[model samples]
Target: MSGKRSIFEEVGETTPRREAPQGGMIDKGRGRARSAIRLWLMVLFALVALMIAVGGLTRLTDSGLSITEWKPLTGALPPLTTADWEAEFALYQAIPEFQVQNSWMQLEDFKAIYWWEWGHRQLGRVIGLVWAVGFLAFLALRKIPAGWTGRLVFIGALGGVQGAVGWWMVSSGLTGTMTDVASYRLATHLGLAFVILGFIAWYIFLLGREERELMQARRGKEAKLFGLATGWLHFAFLQILIGALVAGIDAGRSYTDWPLMGGQVLPPSIWLADLGWRNFFENPGLVQFIHRITGYLLLAFGIMVWMRGRRSANSATGAAFTAAFVALCGQVVLGIATVLYGAPWQVAIVHQVLAVLLWVLILRARFLSLYPLPQSIRRA
Candidate 1:
């Protein structure tokens, strides 16, 4: 045994040195799949965003109902031969969209719209296949993180529902005198898409961080900021649905003026529909008005959220909110421009894409509110 040294003696003589320990088994495996899972989710995110943009283009080109049947398995393969093209065109010709509105279109014209709708459906199939393959591969490898299995499965389930809802929206315009899908159904379809997008985004945010860091950050969560962000997110989502309503019935094209619709505080034709509620969904004037007013309110609330977010102790959190608020401002301006230009396809698609950017920004801010990144104390 080593002898104990006197107080003034060389203290290093009696001190024992030990080896530095390595990570324990518990820490070794936890969140091992986070990076891989995050990469998979990122791919899904891009595909879904592209899907939404393509969907908007499909609607803008009046091609949504061109493919009248929901043959999920068979629909993935686009028409190849001349006979196959004719068969598909015949099915479309039987729909109200073709008979009532595009009777003048030749087989060639029919093929134009057919390709857009086909591409849109084909993208959806690709997204589903990606989700299935990634999830199954992770599960098979036992690499999926604990507490995340259900969340991953939920994304797949929403994708399935989206496919069903897409068909439902398309089916609406197939019968009777409807030259387009019901406005409300279109809104529902778009709303579900946003919801799915939201979930994927939130998951991506969570997975961007380590479980240990996330747990530690939770102690410093800005509750008020999180709450405000949550409110703003919901309000923004509602506005998106309202915007979809406007898009569904081409309301943005009804008014070529901004701040005022048809040179009035409210369009003179705001309540022209036979039923009051129908006016909300079917009246281009009323629908556009609601979309405008809600957009204004959404901006107002977003500003308040930003003001609060700017005061967060964490600089990263503040930066996120600032970006979101800036996008919100840009979106409002774009909305005005879309109205002024009568919702031209180019301007309208830009506006749609901006809305998506703003959505992700708000989600990022909300995530930071719940899990703020540590910042240096050098700032005053």
Candidate 2:
């Protein structure tokens, strides 16, 4: 009996029994919560995109300069009485946009533009309330996973900053020197919004891989591929910034011809202004030409990245690459059409929407590449 017991003990020592708990109901519950948060974040991102599109329409319609005041709180409510409309119109009449550009504009004309500006402000308010409520709910329920609380806080802070930046952009036009907000400030405001969107997408990816089994399965070569995908996602963001600059300067309004501007591969003179560097941003013609050249360069880079992704063994990567390729082509076409159509409000809005969608796809690809679906989930 002692000999048999010794043999059993030896066998037990040789085959190590893992005491670590297999993630069960608790993990599933956590996963469900994480998934819910991810879906919520995605919805929030879509709302943000809608806001951006509407803002672009506001700019294109010259409606940005229609409302001269920035009442952060009460401004959410639009004019409900004739007295209110008169007051709003009176305030707009004081600005240079009214004095110089729209002096002949009537109260009815003012209302046409006022509604767009008001709608934009109201959207900002809605976004703020949604973010605050969602964040608080997560904290109250202890649904946010460990290490993610800090990130959520950062996102909240960004939301605040974005509100401030929107006001800053509006303030630029209020001073009367320029009919529109400074293009540089506009780019900064848009760029920060994109950053917030990208961060939320990344957080979702992290939450989806909450299980140890999923994490282990995703380790190694798959992880490295995800890192590469993230790099491409960042590249797409920079391109969007450049696109914003193009919009801010009214750069797209200048050059209409595709593949050539005024029958030349390049603008006849790269820099026409006395100040060489200033020409890039201030000169609409030069700015448009530069934007076009940059677009082509970005297309080339995106194609290369997509091709490399196709060579990867991961099907997720292959799918991402294909989507990127298709999106880039569609975006390029929309961009050219926008320029040729003279930046019409409807076309311009669609162009901006497509850009946002492309950004979302790039972000999704990066997330999937970083964390491949676990074999069990993939099969399911």
Candidate 3:
């Protein structure tokens, strides 16, 4: 003003201004949405665990053979009236399991078992619907983060394939050759379900990891611990598969004693059958013995993992090790009880439930090890 310069020119000459970076709001919103997706995935994983447990109950109850038809849509709705009940029961009557093994069973008795099978199938339908709705919602809202959509889609496809596999398993028991599903098919189906659950759990872990802030603290040790945890996860999954084989062929029912079968450390003539390989998986006594041996091996591995973790008490890996140790002990006891109890429905179901829980714990340890939280964040 003293020099009589224009106001605008005076301001421009006094200071240069720079525009701040834009799009920060969008980035932050995207991050929040991704976090939400991660939490949702964890919820989905919990539901899967429940489904697996329920399926185990169904198997233990001998209710798998109750529902003889594959009616995806119509079967979703249970019998609403007496006529409907009769109609469903008539369909079951035609099945080999009913005609051959359970011909004396009355309609009322059939209904009791039918409800269990119906509940299992209905749960499957619910899971399918829930997955579909969640997926569509995520897609429509653009909530799923980049680099994850394809994996989720693949998981959804697997769910569909699992339905077909379920039917295929049921079909094996409907004909003249077998009264129950093929042990191989049963193992395949159970193994695939576990795989699907594992994938979901891992994806959730990845999502949570991205939201964490990076720290300057040393991570080399943590990284190695994570690798070890991942190994345990893989080993636990393999053990579960072997357990499934034991369940599929009723192997657990055949062997009641622990540490030894028929008063021998190694049951003599375990492979007495004509075909050697067939004996391992097919013969009931051999299969049971192998499963027992595998259990011992799994316990040994778990103990080693726990001990190594204990040696490094300051690390998160130690906590994971402790958890695996506890779970392994619980699982062993449950296995023994299940065997000693003649695989009673209740105890057997609990054993299966524990196996699934051990699997979840192993997965959680691996995730935590891979993406450790900074001490500052932990404290906060």
Candidate 4:
């Protein structure tokens, strides 16, 4: 035999070297992009949370009506000169809030409140810009997942609506004998903020898992528990809105005593002679009474949900509900304490912050219920 070696002696010719299954390439890219988006959303989430806190402070300090004009784009720039400051103050002076409630304020005092409103609006602009930049960067890079483009865009839409809603709430106070924005309008604004926050948080939870994982997890979803958790979530949301209504009318300060309001289970008057349905919104007594009853109902509902959560085979899911229940308990305590203390800014802000915490915890619990993670045998 001639000593000619085969050229393919050292090479592997198995199956003609398939091109690594091109179908999964897109999915891999999508997974990575989804992760990046999730991180960006977390940043937005934190910013929204901070915005809520700042808004609470603005409300508590009676600084909400400091700016009389909407001026969304142009108002971004604050007063840069004494003349500018005077112009801004003059605008505020024309508002009913200044004419009726804050009449004793001078330019310096006006500046104090003006800064709060400006900072609140400025933070909103920053949130909007962050969302836009991140969403556009992903789109430019073609990194957004197949179904996520609309969701990302929706966040921006909601933010735009929120901005308009903010202006509407502000405009409510600028006319006629109104010293503050209507309580219903204030509730609407805060309700939308929490709604946006909820959606962002839920998207984050969904993106935390891979598509395959989420699909597989769906097979084992705890349907009944999910339903219960969902109900609890709705209940909690209602309570938050009621709390907003309470804050809008300074009702928390009205009922300083918790177990009893005004030395009785019910306050003396819940209605005024001329006003009929308006009293429910404008009357501090009725609003606070409604808030108190809703809080109690919320606690009972939380306990029920917690009992159901205890039965979850998945330890992580069970623990999430437990945490939510615990937060609810803490929030109730904070509410009572805030009331006992006449809703001072410090204590009241803490109360509002606890409401935020409770909200996120409930959302987390519900998400976990929807997509329960597998538990380790040892941990189980």
Candidate 4 lDDT over residue span 120-195, tens digit each: 9999999999999999999999998888899999999999999999999988988999898888888999999999
Candidate 4 regions with alpha-carbon error over 4 angstroms: 1-26, 376-380
- Best-to-worst TM-score order: 4, 1, 2, 3
Summarize candidate 2's per-residue lDDT along 52-170 as a digit string, tens digits: 88888888888887777778898878889999999999999888788878999999999999998889888888888888888899999989876778888898899889989988987
| Better by lDDT, candidate 3 or 1 | 1
Candidate 3 Cα misplacement greater than 4 A, ranges:
1-27, 211-223, 272-276, 312-314, 376-380
Task: State each model's C-alpha RMSD to the native.
Answer: 3.4, 4.4, 4.1, 3.9
Instruction: Evaluate residue 240 in candidate 2 and report its C-alpha lDDT on the 0 to 100 scale.
Output: 77
Query: Lowest summed lDDT over 10 consecutive residues: which window, candidate 1?
Result: 23-32
Over the stretch 1-380, how does candidate 1's per-residue lDDT look in tens digits? 25755677765656797878764433367565888999999999999999999999999999899998999998888889999999999998898877778999999999999999999999999999999999999999999887899999999999999999999999899999999999889989989988899999999999887777788889889899999999999999999999999999999999889788889998999897477778988998889999999998998898889999988888899999999999999999999999998899999999988889999999999999999887622276
How many residue pairs clash in all the candidates, one count each? 0, 0, 0, 0
Alpha-carbon error at 201 in model 3, in Å? 1.4
Clash count, candidate 1: 0
Candidate that would win on lDDT = 1
TM-score of 4: 0.93
TM-score for each prediction?
0.93, 0.88, 0.87, 0.93
lDDT of each: 0.90, 0.78, 0.77, 0.89
Candidate 3 lDDT, 1-380, residue by residue in tens: 58786756646564878888764343465777777777777777877788788877777766787888899999988899999899988988888778877889998998988998888888888778878888899999988776678998888888889889888887888878566777777777788889889889778766664432322233434676667777888777777877777777788877677767767877665776586787866777888887787788888888877776666534565576688689889999988888887788788888888887788778876665555545523321
